[model samples]
Target: MSATSFAIETRGVTRVFDSRKGFLFREVSRTEALKGVDLAVEQGAIFGLLGPNGAGKTTLTKILSTLLLPTGGRAFVLGHDVVTDAEWLRPRIGLVLGGERGLYNRISGRENLRYFADLYGLPTAERERRIEEILERVDLSSAADRRVEEYSRGMKQKLHLARGILHRPQVLFLDEPTIGLDPKSARETRKLVRSLVADGVTIFLTTHYMFEAEELCPQLAILSKGRIVARDTVARLRQLVGGDRTLEAEAYGFEDSEVSALRRLPGVSKIIEEEYGPRTRLTLRVRTDEIRPDDVRALLPDHPELEVKERRTSLEDVYLDLVEEEAH
Candidate 1:
């Protein structure tokens, strides 16, 4: 696709932070928060950026939202440069960062919308109309008259969504929009995202929930450290494991020797073990064509007792593979 066909584009976008410490806070070190990252988001696609905590996802989002300047490279939103044309771009993009601070506790949700609508320069008549429409869209119409302090976490999150779309921005940046919500609320938020894309709004979503990205984003980019490790459709990325299938086992106990023994099994590529008090979970990647369920069963230690299951390769597997490769 041509550059103009994209709603958001970046070229070698880089950001560096000068870490300072001391009595006077002198510059002590430099950290490269974003290292020459590049992304091209289609005009009406829900593009997901997945990463671990401190993986530079929020930093990149901030840069694209025109809240911070990049140390190097360039970014454009809706065909307008984020740095040179921020005034034009800001009005066309919406930002919904995860938090409750953006709303005023003393004011009613309706009033908060009114205040933001005014900041966007919407006239009184149009502002009221838009506020009502957005409140209904986010399912906050019943609570619109109540003070923000009275709203639940999910309701507050919905309010954030309503505020983001109040001006009907062409591009929306959602930084962990469902971060603190319950499962039901998060699902609803995902549904709302799909509806907005259906209405022709491009979404740039940053999230740590692998399944959420798998369910919502047709395409995703996995960010690690300060760079993008992989970018493609979830299916294509899952193929990164070649023909390996994940083997998961839940057991009562595990020992270091048993783990070492499992690692020595033929066709086993990797193993990750987790313990939760008395229960333990083990995830293994094995060449499906070469290893059978019986093969895995025969190698298990007899005392611990384990239940084994074969699972399909998922986005999280692909993400870990890429990130681990980058680390090495």
Candidate 2:
């Protein structure tokens, strides 16, 4: 689907945290949480907003969910302008803000869903059907009557999640839905999301885990320091950040002196590395236009004993490159 028809679309959407003074008893400060961020999520696609903490994911989500207004730019959710049509837009979207109290501790899971369903104006029969479907889908059927206060963190997260999507919103904004869950629970949650997407539900995900982005989102935007530095599919993004033929490999017993020598080698324009004991794993942005493998081999005459091999680039590598490049 064209991005314009997508469930969520933002154009130069900026959120400036206006400076506010604290009470007379405290000091105050101001910070710009989001800086001219732009993004779009295709209808029915699982789109990811990947960034570290405070990179503006929550700020952006709040703006889109109508919980906060942007200081500048434009944003539309389900074809409704966030600022102008917030009242109408709020019902068509569901949002879960990582871990927060979105439910009543005294309420049972089923009661919670019914409460949300009624709040969303779902008809009685439709509400029953929707609640049943969602409870089963999120695997909460067996404990549907359990009080939320008695639930574990993972269980509570599931309830809040179920409640968010209970009304069958056109857009689901899940901010770290699997944040504190164990590895298995996280995977199961991701799997359920994928199933929902396959059933044509639109999902907007914000996550700190890069692999989660790679797994769930066919389209994604990488936010760095409150701005998008890379946006595309898993493969295209990897290629965008690191062109074809990026040389990456692990080697053992590499000395600090060898790092400098490798930087000077032919076909190597930039040295990307992380130390591993005596060796260093490095990614070299190959300069094939200027120097080929033959050229690199020619330079290796200076260090024939070194262990090195070329390999393809991964999304993790591409992500690091983009973020680090921006930091520089």
Please report the candidate that would top TM-score against the real structure: 1
> What is the per-residue lDDT of model 2 for residues 18-128, given as tens digits with 9 covering 90 to 100?
565667866556677778888888789999988777788988989999999998888988877888899897788898885747788897989988888988899987889
Instruction: Quote the positional error of residue 4 for candidate 2 in Å.
Output: 4.2
The numbered model that scores best in lDDT is 1
lDDT of 1 at 132: 87
lDDT value, residue 235 of candidate 2: 81
Q: Where does candidate 2 stray beyond 4 Å?
A: 1-4, 18-22, 25-27, 244-269, 275-280, 285-311
* CA displacement after TM-score superposition, residue 47 of candidate 2 (Å): 1.0
> Which digits, one per residue and each the tens of the lDDT, describe model 1 over residues 94-213?
999967778898999999999889999888889988998999888999999999999999999999999899999999999999998999999999999999999999999999899999
By summed lDDT, which 10 consecutive residues of candidate 1 come out lowest?
235-244
Q: What is the lDDT of candidate 1?
A: 0.87
Which ten residues in a row are the worst by lDDT in model 2? 291-300
TM-score, predicted candidate 2 vs. hidden true structure: 0.85
